[model samples]
Target: MVHPDKASTDRTCSCRINTNYIPLKLLYLFFIGGQSCATTYRSLFMRHLGMSTQQTGVIWAFERVVSVIIPPFIGALSDKSRHPKAVLITLFLVGAVTLSSMYFVPQEESLNLTNSNVSASENVTAATHVDIEEYGQTFWLLVVLVFASSFSVVGIYPVLESTVLGVLGPQNRYKFGHQRLWASVGYGGAALIVGYLKDRSAESIGDMTGTNRAFLSMFAGVMVCYCCAAIVSAKLPVRVKRDHEGFRFQDLKIFLKKPDACAFLGLLFFYGIDSAILEIYLFWLAEVKFETPSFILGASTFIGAALDIPFCLAAGYLTKRFGHKTLLCFGLGVMALRTFLSAIVVNAWQLVATESLRGITWGLMFVVICSYTSKLSPKGLEASCMGIMQAFLFGIAYSVGALAGGAIFNLMGGEFLFILCGSATFVATVAFGMFSFLVKKKPYEMKDPGDCTSSLAFGKEVAESSADVL
Candidate 1:
């Protein structure tokens, strides 16, 4: 009964929509798979390497900063040449190599400069089975190894994200939350397994030397996983041609002209530090509050990645419904509430509940944060926005926060340290909500090209409080 002309129009529309969603689906699967593989094992690797809480925190912050700083120029080059994939792939290859080296570096004892005065080296020395450093080569090699890793990732992550975004289109693009959720799933699975290993090994490898070997093995696992991810990354779909428009430093400057962009970055920056705080402290929290065995600490992380799936799926639905910023605000609220509740834990069971809280707060929030950022950048400006996000939030601020977290954890006394950590999350949540509110009196649609493909398609039509997700 439909008119012939209308039927033809409908057919064409359906065709375009199919064309749009299919590529994005593959892109999402690939991205999630690769990211999970990379983040999950990589996280376990860092934890195993005997990096101090302070060192790990700073490393995380620096990694973000370095990633932001270097990628723009590299991405600009890739963009100008119409080959975003070129730069991204090159970085991946480098990452595969650099990450491989970390496995061999000797694990060291986590530095406890701020730690409570405990038994000195001499007290444990007599009972210790073997010295961790025989030739001492492992200790010195660690510094070089980490530097390579930091450099390789800095080169790859932004470019990989930008290309994926570019290919997905604007409307109903690949979902960032979905991708992040999988990454967490990967992380959680590894954490749980490692938790059991650490727990079981404790009595057998009570010696520090034996424990170092187990930790070193974890680094090896990360390198293998990352190498595979790099190989998969090479096959992602992004055309290697510059667009009609030219890219220059001026394009990077466009971020300042967009308030939504600034506001989102501010939220991201604070949230980055807050999440970093949770990650660095979760194990310690487990030990102090639960009196848990090391095995339990390892077990909790085993589930970090798995738990992220629901949040990732939710992010997709939420981005389609309440919008990314609103979802982020909501997530932050949930996290702050969890942290505040955690401040009052009375038993080990309560500690387990706190881990769940940590996962939800940091893990799920990671989903929309990256996606919203992707949605707010102008075309070809994905790297710059990513860079700026890294520069402000993750790089210096987080690095400092990591250092501060360790200092404060030592200085403040554990009895009430939960309050301090919770306070940071709450403040960040408050800042995010307040600034987001004051940005506009009403909802408005604004589009920015992201590091995802779908952001370019239907999302091309941006609006406040509503999204054009297919």
Candidate 2:
């Protein structure tokens, strides 16, 4: 019934929508594959290589340093080129090759002293001996490969985040919760599978050699996933080309000028320390302190990740109703409690139970933080802002935490280390809560901004409720 010209216009609109929709679907798949490779098995593989706690911490800190240096540059490059997908594809391929090469690195079994009450200096001396006598060339090779792979892997995140944001546009940006849930599914699924494989390998083959073979299988699986992710990344389409002329460090001054932004970044920095400790130390705690089996350790990860799905799905609704500050404070408070409890756990089952808190603590916190940061970013500088924020959170804060955790683990042992981290997080929570209460918004902005006004009112309510405690 339509005229030929009208019909042609309708077809063009449909084609445009399809183009954007297809890329988003592919990007989701890429997340699934990428998370499977990166999150589920990296630390376990390192442990299997006979690296001591301090040695592992040093290596991880080096990776964080690379993350600090590279992601910003990659983000800037993508901003200029207007070819984020191309950049991502290249990074994925590089990551696949470098990470796969890690499988071939030789490892000699070192002294297992995780349970000893060794001094930090003593641990360092032991680690040095292992590096020289047992690790040697293979150790340096692994470090080199990690540096190279991390340069690419860390860079991929901001680009993927930008692409997802671009695809969703302003109107539906809040719906990012739905998209992120897929990553949780991917992590959980991979953790379960990898854990089962590791347990079976240990049972069938036996000894340190069996563990080595299991780790090799895990790395191989990661390579396959990376390859699939690269293929999917290559197919993504960039809809808009942002102007990149006159870009300079001065452009970042806007964030520094805002008091709220500074407070938020500080909060993120402290939270980063807590998070890094959990990621780096929890596995060792399980294997050494509690004598938990490989399958159970993997199951713990799967449980945490699986539980994240519901929290991620509900993030948007929760943020909308309770506001960012309340959710953030609540999540941090839960984290403090989790860490304190972790310090007291005597058995593997108790540790598993404590880990369930991760769903609320990390899951909700990350979603809210990402959304908040995205909303606060200056135009055309989303990727840069994200990169800088990540550098502070994962780079500086994580490095400090990792190194200190190792030293603390060696000097004072697990209980004291957890207590220290927990106390720090608790203090941060109180400081953040006080900041939220005392920092009144300017009167010049008389017009009520819905979320901002709601957040302020919520802060006032919380302040009143805890006045005596404060």
Candidate 3:
């Protein structure tokens, strides 16, 4: 028979683990799953609606511009707010509605064209006028919807990361990979399922065009997943440990003074540019060059995401063994190779093989960057740090990539664009290594006595504060 105290201890430990892991797992699974359901196919949907690649790029770049302006403020707000979870849930709901609504916008070909008793030239002119008006309206509407969705989704991402880090506390941060791997599972699985369904005949899905109806079906899945995610967001243990010295916007300057920190941020910006180009144009390349099927494209993504599971699980170990600076170089080196391979791949299967290297570049890199950012974060200002990171990675850099990549792809072609990106990444990786070697490490001296270390205390404080609120 087990000793009574020991048994109680075991039970308590199990409960604590469950309380921390289960809700976050479900939140990631459903939230990312919902996003993947639509995100993987969004570009295709825009293309199907008669939008040119440049037009699509313009829309994406515009949204990234908004992300630049909004996410940091939202992160600051979350840090200051007593009820950050409520704000996150509200963002989720808004993002879900706006993103899903994009699918239901009337297709360009569906515009009314019937006109009786007109000369041929007159009719042609009238048709051109109607087409221009409709195209402009549709384009602007899609842009608005995309902006709204991006504002909520991008703004919430860093805050969500802060919540996860806060809940896990500093000691258990190594397990972040385990938590993040669930997002890959959700992404890969959703892509696989939706792709399979999308590949089905039009007759089976009750529409003459398989792609259009498939996206409509995806809208329903997004709503269900988002609703579930919002419900579970309430369960997240987000405690705001009120610091006597409140986080000021200017406090970030002190944190940025470290040479290594500045290098990392610069790396992220350039890395963002290369990654955005791939994200925006890779599938389009596969489709246009090799006539890749929807299911094959999905399979490619599934394969890459599946690799993320293993890579993410290994991230902490890799960082522990090689250190963050080494791993950053390694990840960038891998990205350069991947981009170079993308330029030369002649077949869809080869494209998939090359893309699967994202396990290292995207998956491992994400974990490393997030962990590094967390490590560098000042006490009581974790959200602000993550927000700035997101702004650099996804907002400003992504916008530049989208706009520049589109122009490059139009002028020089996709293969040439990838080659240029790959070469630039390789050069950046080398430059970063040289910079890190030259720059001396600065000792972090806190300007204020109110500050503390990176370690976060969670659980009981959260429970007590939540109870008081309730």
Candidate 4:
């Protein structure tokens, strides 16, 4: 619900961009760093604790627990603050302190033992063999660090990204790709560094202590990157009213009964499953099916992701040239084609080749989704809607995607399972796509900000809004 009286049309704002270009660069870096450290680095970091597929599963599950619960809740908090920028800055500082503790936390033994059973001494995580108690202590410490670093994902991320979008407005949407391109650059660069280190030092790191030290360096690198991101985040000029929504707990009961709300969730139900397949299975197709080493997995994926830069730019152009719905359909259709191709990929080269197709679909989807979400954002609850989107939908999607993807691999065999993922994407796309079209009532006009007094809380609304983006 947007307040019709809220004269704060984001496009019309005149706040000065005192620290403009450089902060934008830092924003890109921090955005990438925040995502990689908070979500992507978990696999490598888990190995250091000698976690098993199951133990690692548990750790990730725990992290997802917070991700599922906190982001939207905190998003509500961000929506109301007089200065959401301040809240974002504070989150970074808190994350820095929490993440720093990873340098000194004890390891978890039970998880480490599981990893050893799965992989040999050489194959196991470097710290796996340190006495179980020490490992347990560190693992527990990591649980805290994971929670802390997640500030970027759970709440602060929407706050920060919304701030960037608020500044860029509709005019500069084309540049959004450029910003995300920097994120791909950071990940690709990090991957190269990690690959070089692992290849060059694999033999010398035969000793457990040496392995542990190397993994620590990786963690430290992630922290350094995040620190730089925090610096960039401090300087963006974002202006939006900050006040809590008036929706209450009772509204939560009938929240979905609203027509647009029902249609939106229905669209997401399948969209999420399809999106989850790509998130989890693509890497599997590359790493496992192709027998690509873990060290270079990031590098290979980054190569494919690098292709997304052009797609992102193209997406911006197409979205602006055509419309949000058109590009989204195109992107989803491309993904469907890619999924179909992935099922039959026979080698690493084939996988890489087809994986290149991923950029257009993924890049287009991202830009379209973000743009659409921005259009529907209520006057003040921008972060809240974004939070519900990332956490409630995609957060759950990622977690289930990981576990379910693995199960699919085991049940159907990797090739067949991947094929199934592609098919699901295709079928679900049609289903969800139709629903998206069905919800075209003037969702925005029906619900004004005044209608959504504090009686409403965060993302739940009687009409379609930003949460529909996910």
After superposition, the stretches of candidate 3 with alpha carbons farther than 4 Å from their true spots are 1-17, 109-135, 201-211, 244-247, 440-470
lDDT of 2: 0.70
Local distance difference test values of all predictions, in order:
0.54, 0.70, 0.74, 0.56
Best model per lDDT: 3
lDDT of 2 by residue, 1-470 (tens): 99999988865553333345445545554555555555456665666665656666777788887777776778778878888778888888898788778887766444564446887557656655565446556557778998998878888887788777767555445545556665666666676677788778777777765236766556666777677777777766556655553235675797677787788888887788888788788777767677677677767777877788778766766776876777888888888888888888888878678878888987778888886675566765555677778878878888888878877876788788888999999999999889988998433221222222234533432332222111
Better of 1 and 2 by TM-score: 2
RMSD to native, candidate 2: 8.6
Candidate 3 structure quality by residue, lDDT tens digits, 1-470: 99999988865654444455677878888888888886777777776665556666787788888887687777767767767798889988998899889877765553445356767556544544454445566578898899888878787786777777677665555566668887888888887777777767334766443246756656776888888889999998776767623336676696698677788888887798888788888887877798777788889888998899878766755765676778898899898889889889978888789879989997899988886776677765655677777887889889988888877876688899899999999999999989877877554444222122221212332222222111
The residue ranges of model 1 lying beyond 4 angstroms of the native Cα positions read 1-65, 80-90, 107-141, 171-180, 198-206, 244-252, 288-291, 302-304, 341-349, 358-364, 413-418, 446-470
Looking at model 2, the pairs that clash are: none
lDDT tens digits by residue: candidate 4, 1-470: 76755546542332323245446656666656545543444454555454433344445555566777666666666666657667776777677666656656443444334443465544344443343324355566666677676665456656666666556553443345545555666655565565456445545667654235545545565667767766666666665744446223343334444564444444444455555555545554555456555455556556766777666555545654566655666666677777778778666556567767757766667766665654455544444455555665556765665566655654566577667767776776676667667766452331332222112311222122221111
The digit string of per-residue lDDT tens for model 1 on 177-238 reads 43344455555655555555655655566665424554543444455556555555555566
RMSD versus native structure for model 4: 9.3
Error of 3 at 277 (Å): 1.4
- How many residue pairs clash in each candidate at the backbone level? 42, 0, 0, 21
